[model samples]
Target: MKSYLAPKFIIERDTERCINCKVCVNQCSFDSHYYDADDDKVKSRIGKCVGCHRCVLFCPTQALTVRENPLDYRANYNWSPEVIEDITKQAESGGVVLTGMGNDKSQRIYWDHLLLNASQVTNPSIDPLREPMELTTYLGRKPDKIDIDKQDPQSIKLKTELAPQVKLDVPVMFSAMSYGAVSINVHKSLARAAVEMGTLWNTGEGGLHPDLYKYGNNTIVQVASGRFGVQPSYLNIARVVEIKIGQGAKPGIGGHLPGEKVTAEVSSTRMIPHGTDALSPAPQHDIYSIEDLSQLIHALKEATNYTKPISVKIAAVHNSAAIASGMVRAGADIIVLDGFRGATGAAPKIIRENVGIPIELALASVDTRLRQEGIRNQASLVISGGIRNSGDVIKAIALGADAVNIGTAALVALGCRVCQQCHTGKCAWGICTSDLFLSKRLNPDIGARRAANLLRGWSHEIKDMLGGMGINAIESLRGNRLHLRGIDLTDTELEVLGVRMAGN
Candidate 1:
């Protein structure tokens, strides 16, 4: 079992007042409390508590109280409440903030501000249960037109074999998160879930773990600047190859895996010196310009023998449209736009809140620019960075995305409280930490099943939304501006969104 020496805050329950309702047990997203069948009492494994206050707030009897251990350090001027709390815990243990995935602070989650529309009674909502509800989606370029030679069927040759469609059972995809950030068990769980659910999971810029090769057909290998654990064999073993330009949490800033967290195994996989920081440089050495981007794309294609689709992922920014256009021109088969306000393992507070644009505006602008340039159909669009539920997924598609990538939501399904302490590595919930004992708290089978259930639930809801719109298939919803309308938006916003007045 992995060992740690950090002081912990414990949540105690008033045994006299505890009625064994299991309310606190169920309400605690961290799974800190459980029913002790032998003792006939509710017990809290307080070490798992992240002080989210969910249990305290939800306890009907107000019987729960959380207190910091005396050993917990007091904050000094150098460390604010948040910083002190993080450092105290991590400093005592000497570990990275063990977060599951994504940044999840109270930063602006734009999806909430921008809402979806359901067909009015006048438009007539179709019954999805009775009718055929279509959620099947293809994630690749669509041909503008199919040429036919009716006069000489045998003589006519095809322009080229069309790119194969990335057949998603649902429009939702598991977002990129590295194996090192999470655990190999966690990676296996995600891969197994993806294959079972007919979706895809991204192998974050961290190279593919050899153990996960079985799920290759449903995997998308990611290549980032550091080239950590990347090789021709790794590149060749994926359904799609994604080039990560930036992340929503820290757009221009790169990731730093402190030397302390670099285990021998992790060091070997990443091809870095043991016990030294594994720094992913902010900018790729090969990609200085759009032409340079093309060279890297070609290199990957050559390495993979051009079998897998190539995707470029960029953080949403003010110039996202221009950047996306350049990526398409750089031979990207798909483009993933990660919005501002997305979750992260660890990022400076200012950068997390200020660096990137909202997914809504970025999606609209990029789609409009690509369509205007007559190149929208040349590649697929996948939007990430705070996609919360099925409604957000449907709205993203109608706004012009081919699919949605979810990191935060998937982690929630696997038991994350979003305590915002991921960087400190002592994830009370086993989902994020690498500690053997803490990690065992999450059973990979159960976690993977839960994730699969969440995806299945969302798929059903998406189908219901599409059916309510009188739309039969997910493809019909792709870039269907006519089915959408803006609310509380200014004239300029409406113009940018390509939506007119509600009645019109």
Candidate 2:
């Protein structure tokens, strides 16, 4: 069947520099490059290229160049090139269009519109280089009041009982990315980095691998609808246990790890059969209401003997504020909101681009609602999805996020190009694939160092930003939206974000 699709990228090899080394042929996982015995030359079939740039990176002589195919079509804003190509692709495949990573649409990124305030003269900014700046954060419920008994100035006693909390040296955590969805080396890297950075890393419903049990202190075991590998040990081994209700990338749909990506190791870790697709139902069959959710939350706490906090993760949606209120009232110690721009291993193109609300607005609303109801101290708030840098992390904290999670940013440090080819299980960078040959490309030792270095750099930047605001501790910045001002934003956007306009 002669398909009507054109090559997405054009591969141009410099024949004069090409040495016919077959390096491109071996490096390309998409089968775009091939060795032609008839002509004794290295050639490329551009149609199969996914634009991963693996071959281009490995070409010793630097003879290969790949660029967007720039195929012209009738100009119609309503029927844009991408739209027409999507329709054509579906017509030929008769299957849902699948993609990896977050939404690439030109949606309003609130971070760019929001500006941070710095102290001028009255506040007197502190120098982070010479002064002490605290970035330590705790994730868990907090007591409304603490009772104290002062027998003497030096011998005060009688304190309030504190809820179990996970202490983080910094407020940034590595977001959940499952085993089957990515290679085990990536998991090892995350786990090791979390330990070194004194933060936590989530295991995204794929369950924990046996080797990762040693990093339990820095691990967050996830329980999705599938309950792939839920056991008493699994519940007890982690610092925190999170219940995954929804993700920002595909809110209403379930998670799908295709059978081809599921190997023996993944099957063992997730407790599913080898070569079987791991699908988590959209909704937890056991949870119909907030009451049901409370039961499960209590069940997990009971399983862990109340030694750790239980977190509830949900996608940022229209009714997030109301839903978050219920979750706190339902015995949740921590609430995680994954915003619309969150990344994923696989999701339908339609849903990834359309559904869910932005994390900025969602964070502001939820924080405002919680404060209004005086339940803000009952549970900690953590935001995720599209957190790109330390500036975004500090902005999130000012908007009421106790901490932020980074998935795509962490992957980028590990060499992901955001090529969106992860779902095909052919990730040339080896960060997102499970194939033995490709998975080894990511060395856990090097990966761990790179991921940890990212945290270190961001932590330094966060302290600098905080010091510029004349704040020495991160806790003081929490829910302090006064330090944030909006530019090029609507009145409604400013109101929803709980921020004043710039120059106000």
Candidate 3:
């Protein structure tokens, strides 16, 4: 007795081009293809396909085609097929519906609404190839003002010294993806890529793999509510230690690594019992207030002997600006703001779709609040959630982000199709599954190299954009909202973004 829900994808094979090599049957991990021994031909269970197209690539004969299944039900704009199907799924399973990747709905993409300005006769644009365009960014606290020693006027020795900063050659870095959520090779690729690109990769909640200790210089180890794999060594090994207060995908909720996904290796890394649910409590019980946050922030600094910067990460909620201010005053040298459209390995579908605001608004608001409070120099701001390309990175910097973290895009480059089946523990791509067979699909060297290439290409694009703006350094773009102009946004949107209309 199979469920009557319509299949989302249709797997078609051209009979004339079929060589009967059975490669399509063997390649698909979803069991969509099978050999019919009685008929001596290959057949497909179209309803089972997630349309990842992995088999299409392996089919040497080019006989396979995957497409979206035609909708049979009457079209209604409000209660659409996806909504109806989700209801059926929840009714049948009696479980929370799950999805992977990011939000798939049409929402206000502020990046599209904001346009970048270019230099003209008054300020001629510089050629990136011929001029010196700087893309390197340092993430950490900065001094508000410099005081020089009068005795050594020629040397101009600083009275106040600078704090520890993680210098990144590129403003884009790979975001957090936990060990139980993504394969070890994925982590290795991120670590290797960060090292090669001169950036840092965040170890999301999950503990750092022992093999990756060598790349600790480029690692940003996290201490979330679960405190998974958090130790003195964890604090000391990384260039920065981040505290994960909440995530954009499921704000006010905790992380859920299903018992089914808790493999032996994952258990060892998370220090939890095998085949048991690893649920992080919604709030760090110790951190009941902002003062409590200060305790933990200083604790990490103390453990690291004040050698590394401490970052506090929070979801961009309605009061994100106020919360960011508290975090900066609480001894945080860096602040990470994750918006609603952020990707998650697993989260309740309702919470994923309906919670939090966009990163664009959150970043603009938080940066303004901090600057107004005169704490802008107290901490560096890093933002994430639905950052699609180099343009998005450039726009984020213009809106006041020191750096941007990219998770879904990096995974896409590593062959992820975003089929939204991550909760089932059977990711079609090797990026987000613990299954040994599936994990083998991603080669670490290739994955790392691909990640590096993405950063390199984006870095070049950033330089190009900067040169067009007549700005020589990346810091000049930070919080420089004057360089951006709004298109069709409302009065409030423009005011929140601190930008003018395109014409004015």
Ranking of predictions according to lDDT:
2, 3, 1
* Candidate 1: RMSD to truth: 6.4
What is the lDDT of every predicted structure here? 0.80, 0.94, 0.90
Q: What is the lDDT of residue 251 in candidate 3?
A: 90
TM-score of each: 0.82, 0.98, 0.97
**Candidate 1 Cα misplacement greater than 4 A, ranges:** 1-12, 15-49, 52-110, 120-124, 149-159, 501-504
**Global fold similarity of model 1 (TM-score):** 0.82
TM-score between model 3 and native: 0.97
Model 1 Cα lDDT, one tens digit per residue, 1-504: 443444367788898887888988876556789999999888898477767566786788888988775564465766645566566557677655444245545654544545555688778878888988878878875677776655677688666567656899988999988766666667777888898899999988778877888889999999999989889888888899999999888899788766655666667778888778778899998889999999998898888887888899999999999999999988899999999866776666657766788888899999999999999988999999888889889889998999999988898888776767766555555655555555666787988898899999998898888887877899988988777776666788778877665655
Identify the superior model by TM-score, candidate 1 or candidate 2: 2
